[model samples]
Target: MEENRLPFDAVILAGGRSSRLGGVPKQDLVFHHATLLQRALAASAGAAGTVVVGPRPEFSLPGVILCREEPEFAGPAAAISAGLEALARHCTSASEYTLVLACDMPLVQDAVAVLKEALVPAKGDGVMARSGDGTLQPLAGIYRTTGLKKAAEELASRGTLNNGSVRSLLASLEVQPVTVPAGSTADVDTWDDAAALGIAAGNQDKKPGPAQPQLTWEARS
Candidate 1:
């Protein structure tokens, strides 16, 4: 943590209707002996407070705030709004930014740290992770708390938040993109994605004990 870098509070969005993976809750999926939600929480261990926005998580984590977007399964934008509301209670003058993450990204910690470091060199509303193909992974980024709150609120007020896209929520903010490694932006939406990430297939989804790390971000050229 640098003196100039804002203290981070985090919001993990876990409430999605996983229609692609036979309705399995992505947050409940295992990765390296931990649930996807747990891995996400571990990554935010440095934050002042962490909020998990979704239906009640299967596992309990002390000091974590669990919330859900209004109307349920209301997409990322509404989920973000729900997270912002939970965060408002815990944010202080020292907590200037929010680290937003999607629960399904299993290997996002390094990129999370890198995004934090990027904040030191680039001044913007936030530092977002960009995929190799140049798509913005908005959930894998740090945002100024005030700016995010405003954006979330504006979208909700406009009545477009239910199942709304994240891009709409962030349309007004000046976000700097830091290109992250491939799997850092990978999210599991289908069974193939899960299996590719070391998650067992079929009846073996719970083959548990602990799986190994499936990918790591390589150094930039």
Candidate 2:
């Protein structure tokens, strides 16, 4: 792919029932010192703009477009649909591919390159990032708005949107699977999950997660 041939937009799914964290907004929850949304934004900043789908707007960032779901919300699927709809209205084409990343992932590294390499289909296509363990990480993946619209519309028409989750959506399309490094796919869901990331990142509960100096990821394009 050429340097500027970005084939998709990135949608960061922040709308979720963070019941595990006492119903706290996952995007607002801080990991070490950075908020989850901040980490997510940093991870997705270079992926053609970011759209945050969530209920609360209090944690809104500068560059991210915060959008909540309609119909009182169903789940991530609903939020994703809402984001896609809004993105479609603003963009030139609604058929453009979108990389839908969950906001809870603190270990997302080089998302632009990962999604770029994973987006392998001609015309319109979908892709998902898989960990070294081979589990299908549905949230950290891609979805064409056209494909999502089809499924969402169908489900909405039937008066039953229960079956149109991200997992089912990817199953319905020819999705490319990209392999991420071992520790780059942790989705900080529960309190335990965040704690584990802190421990792994060399930050215990008392101390904060110090930003490690590295030459792997450059600050600029």
Candidate 3:
């Protein structure tokens, strides 16, 4: 609740098929002392409201609006659309932005603060973290609710949301891409990736703190 920070809502996309991970839901995958979804919810606790778009899991957190995409397991874009709809139900005028996140990213919390802070100066539809290898981590960003709603509606109209690419949804928006340090955008798409992050095999002692300021975009060109 910093004076300079704009109020926002949060949408955690947790409805993935996890085809490569033996059909286990990634959100339920645990790391440290919490599940991936729990970590995401904790990181976004500062938001005015939070909507988790996926099946309601046995593990619950207070104040989280749990929902699922229509047709279930549609795709990321469809999940986003579902999340936006849930967000609309609870958002107030004070909510200016929506933080979009994927549940598989265990280390995403470190990127949240910086993305929200950068969104102000960005003056764009949203601000996403760019990996050190130059990949856009769209799910790990904050977006203007108006812009996101418009995009979601347009995608639904075109009947492409169910299987559409997120890049397509963002193509029309003016986005700020801020580069982040290595591992900040690392996600568990497979057991190998999870093990690498010290999550799959239970190595919680390796958890790192937020990326150093020197490794953030603010310190780079």
Candidate 4:
């Protein structure tokens, strides 16, 4: 690892149903000439190892370990567990920290940078991103490997890993929140969100439609 960089692994959650986006996979959505998933991969390019947790995409992804949650689309918590297991199984050495990211956020690179910088001086279990609007974004956080494993184990012990909320997985961790730039934590959950972020559906073939009325960012549910 570079002297200025910390050794870490990355787990990207890409298994959402996209129910609000007419079943279009958000990972396939394009922004700035790259799919959302590709953008996420680029954001975590510095990690020693990366595991993408979700249904395997049709296209090839070089140098990435791909896996799915036990029940498939179970939830972020379950997906995270599977990613951690994949990392342990495939990587020769474990990193001290893990980056957990949601692929739907196109501008996550900014958040990652902020979290990583904050982590250097942080004494907590990890550092989470707080959006400019003050919303805590756990999915954009970097966490201590041991802390994540412990939390996953505790959730599994209670039989709640599957379909469990990300909040539950981080409930026991001591995380410092660092504010990120505006729109850094914005995620594409709906067509309106895609428009707000200037993303286009990758599978669409229609010509560009009339300009969409501007919409404000919606809080993640």
Candidate 5:
């Protein structure tokens, strides 16, 4: 869309088979009273259009464009490349950037802004999420059009190097870190992890126990 004014496109990485989450897609799981995919979409409001990259040929998403990984089921790199290519094709502007976000991260908002701040036009690539101590988050990073094309081409020619992992591509990129805020990197992989994160975040939303009121001995006073 208007990538010129922070209008970069968005990619929702929902390609994971999610075997850890009982062999079902984690994106379809309930989170914060909504499907994980729905929450991810809501956070991508700045993107002009969104694409869901998955392996299921019959996959469907209402109001959002759907595209399967080019060499469906290859791995994360394949999914990322396919999503970027799809975004490029759909976008009229040839120079716009694309933000790649994983579907399982329910607390990764403000990522786009962090990326925008770290983007150095002279550097050719934008920013990516890094942990508080600076660990790159490739799946939740901003990718410039040129960088994305290069990454895709490399992936194609190398037959998906680094075991077809997005981490490999991210490591090779000229990346900058968007230091994650405290408690913002919670990703729901195993059901256990989901439960833990849910409990933590849910607890944060509630007020702490107040001072215990004095018990009244008088009956029905």
Candidate 6:
């Protein structure tokens, strides 16, 4: 790793049922002429390795290790565990930290930059992003590799990761929450959210036009 770079790998959670979007895959939604998953990969491009946990998308994912949770459609916690395992098997060099991200956030690059910049001064097992409204966005966090792996192991030992909540998985860790810029952690959970982020489903082939208006932080909340 370079002197200015942090030694880390990335785990992107891309496997959600998208029940709110009526089964439309959030990762496939087009934003600025790129799929949400593609945007997420670009955001974490600095990582030593990246593993996308979910069903493989139709588009080619060059240089990405794709895998799915054991039961498929398992919760984020399970997906995270599977990502860790994939990293262990595929990554030649283990990193000290892990970037955990959800693929639905189009502006996640902003949040990733904030978390990485804050890591040097923050003292904890990880640094999680706190949105403008003070909601903790654990999915946008950077965690110590050992800490996260241990947490996953503990959860698996208790047979709880399959349907486990992210809150439960991080309960044992000491994490510093850093406030991020407005809209940095906003994600596409519903159609309204996609609209607010200037995202449209099934429009990857269309060229991006003028930049779309983004919703205010309050409006998004």
Best by TM-score: 6
Pairs in clash, predicted candidate 3: none
Which candidate do you rate higher for TM-score, 3 or 6?
6
- Number of residue pairs clashing in candidate 6, backbone atoms closer than 3 angstroms, sequence gap of 3 or more or interchain: 0
What's the TM-score of each model vs. the native? 0.87, 0.78, 0.87, 0.89, 0.78, 0.89
lDDT of each: 0.79, 0.63, 0.77, 0.83, 0.65, 0.83
Q: Candidate 2 — which pairs collide?
A: none
Local accuracy of candidate 5 as per-residue lDDT tens digits, 75-187:
77777777766766775664467778888887777665556666644264777787786666778877776777787687679776424788666655676667867546568
Cα RMSD, each candidate: 7.0, 6.4, 8.0, 7.7, 12.6, 7.2
- How well does candidate 4 match the true structure in TM-score terms? 0.89
Residue-wise lDDT of candidate 2 within 89-208, one digit each (tens)? 555654366778887887775544576665654344566788888987878876666787787676667765643577655545666777877767787767788777772333323222
- Which ten-residue region of model 3 has the weakest summed lDDT? 212-221
Weakest lDDT window of 10 consecutive positions for candidate 2: 212-221
Pairwise lDDT winner, candidates 3 and 5: 3
- Give the runs in model 4 whose Cα sits over 4 Å from its true position: 1-5, 202-221
Tens-digit lDDT track for model 1 on 1-221? 47345678888998888999888889889877777877787677678867888877544456677777888988998888888776675545437888899989989887787787788777879899998888889989888888988887787788888888988888999999998877787889999999889876444343323332332222110
Choose 2 or 6, whichever is better by TM-score.
6
| Model 3 spans > 4 angstroms off | 1-5, 92-94, 201-221
True-structure RMSD for candidate 3: 8.0
Model 6 residue 50 lDDT score: 84
lDDT tens readout by residue for model 3, 1-221: 35246888888998888998888888777777567877787678678877888877654356677778888888888888888887666555537788899988888878886786677678779898898888999989888888988998898898888888778788788989988767877999988998887775443332223421111111000
